[model samples]
Target: MVSVSRYGREMGSVFDLLGTHEPALTAALGWALGRSPELMSRFLNRLGLNGSSDVSDVAVQLETADEAGRTDIELFTSTAHVIIEAKQGWIVPGEVQLTAYAPRLDAAATSGLDTRLVTLSDSTAAWAHEVLPAEVSGVAVIHWSWDDVRDLIAEARSKVRGTERLWLDQLEDYMGAATSKRPVTDALAYCVVISNDLFGDATFRDYVVNQRVYFHPVTGGGWPTVPPNFLAFRWDNAVRQVNRVVDYEIVAHLSERFPSVADDHSAGSRPPGDAHVVYRLGPDIPLPDGGIPSGKQNLRAQRFWVLLDQLLTQPTVIEAREATKELGAT
Candidate 1:
């Protein structure tokens, strides 16, 4: 009998083993999509398409022309036809690449069929959102991140059983691992500035002084190196008495940008660099009731050094945010 362990040893997954054979991945996705109507509905919803939960028919890698091109994954019914273009990793298809498939998609949308085009990526494609809508002639273009797909599968898992459920679980695990590996070089760190009347907001300054937290921004390039899922904080020049060195693992990467309304105390926007990654702070190190211990010596880097040393010994700190939560709950 064919077993997963035997195959997994040679390749990270059956999907990886298939490599550039888009047809195989298409077939796999098609099967999964058909089996889970909720998955199909959520997918269609992301593409801004209206569809019933019931999926009637699905096709894989349909070739429209020998050398021309093919649709990666096609879902069809009496009313709708969705042409999906999927990317595995960092490679993003340009408007020209997607434009090539427009003809095939248009031709398929006959007999009053509502046509939609979708591009799937492992991460958000800001450029695709900007370009694909205008470039693809007749069809409506939408983008879906791998995380969106994984969430759909996870939601559908509860409704499946037997080997189907096992397969869904495995696919979710594979996608999670693959997407997490995407490198994030630049991030916007949110910190608290504890200085006297810096921004002329006396009320805000009082709050910061009381809570012992202030809002500060740090760029990835400014630091020696930014380890993934970590927040590195720097104090403003005005703040002479505060921790000079401290960092915490980022928990939730919030969609909100830095220098937000609350950041009026901050000098300006994050320094020019790559895209600014935003995050919510993780758990802070246990502090005394008085906070950070009093005195000029308390501001030394050694204080933070000792805290980080202890944090590094914890396995949860090294893992992803979700995994860290699971460890804590146990």
Candidate 2:
């Protein structure tokens, strides 16, 4: 459940609504899929289907009723001809769970539909992202977590139907639980950092970013992200390891996940996998080039400078700085 203070006592906020009552979420999702179909069918009618006027819901299997298990939801996007396996819930029933579908999918495959799988759960999706066996090939898999789905649904519904109160309540409930609601860092940064830490290491944008991020969840409401291309993440801590330089080549690593941010925006700019800033504690070597110059600094760097001001306010870093500044400054 989300924080009570953010949502208020009136309604159980969005997070509370879903987190507290998952059955409702499942019901809503079923409704959403039933109406829209799990995979889009807009142009599916054109994608070479057998005797189709307008391709809609080529086939849907609510795995809950199937012998496989009740939690999984399978959808085939008629337009794309890809089977979207909405394998959600807590437990992921490995090889056996998927194999059960092989026969049904193979039969569908014979007709035309391309087979693909996308798992829509929190941790299971993350788990699938990492350990997707080599056997699972020629399939497109996307991981959309519970919170992400719920938020998107709430936002969309709130606007069209004027569920402002529901949306507001949800936002308030979530913020109440959130400890650091500062906009400095991106939304889901904490969740991502922690999830990757527990599961593995962070992928840092997971691809190059060239498109505008246009969505900052931390800012609350629906503020967009700092252009994914513009944002940077560099580590600074008490512990030292790998010269920090060893950690800089992550630019190219994110090409797949954020092609818009990775390819488009960075086209004429610096190549991928390069650090935007030098990230030094002091004005070391006076910044060889591309350094934060006296006045021609970017607004982002200025923001960094503001944080630098706060960093300076830290009693220890400042006390250390005071001792050293008198040594060099006029």
Which candidate comes out best when scored by lDDT? 1
Error of 2 at 43 (Å): 13
What is candidate 1's lDDT per residue for 94-163, written digit by digit as tens?
6777787777666566666778777776434653454356447867777776667877787778877877
TM of each candidate vs. truth? 0.50, 0.34
Q: Ten consecutive residues with minimal summed lDDT in candidate 2?
A: 190-199
| All models, RMSD in angstroms | 10.3, 14.7
**CA lDDT, every prediction?**
0.47, 0.33
Q: Give the lowest summed-lDDT range of ten residues in model 1.
A: 246-255
In model 1, what lDDT does residue 72 have? 71
lDDT for model 2, please. 0.33
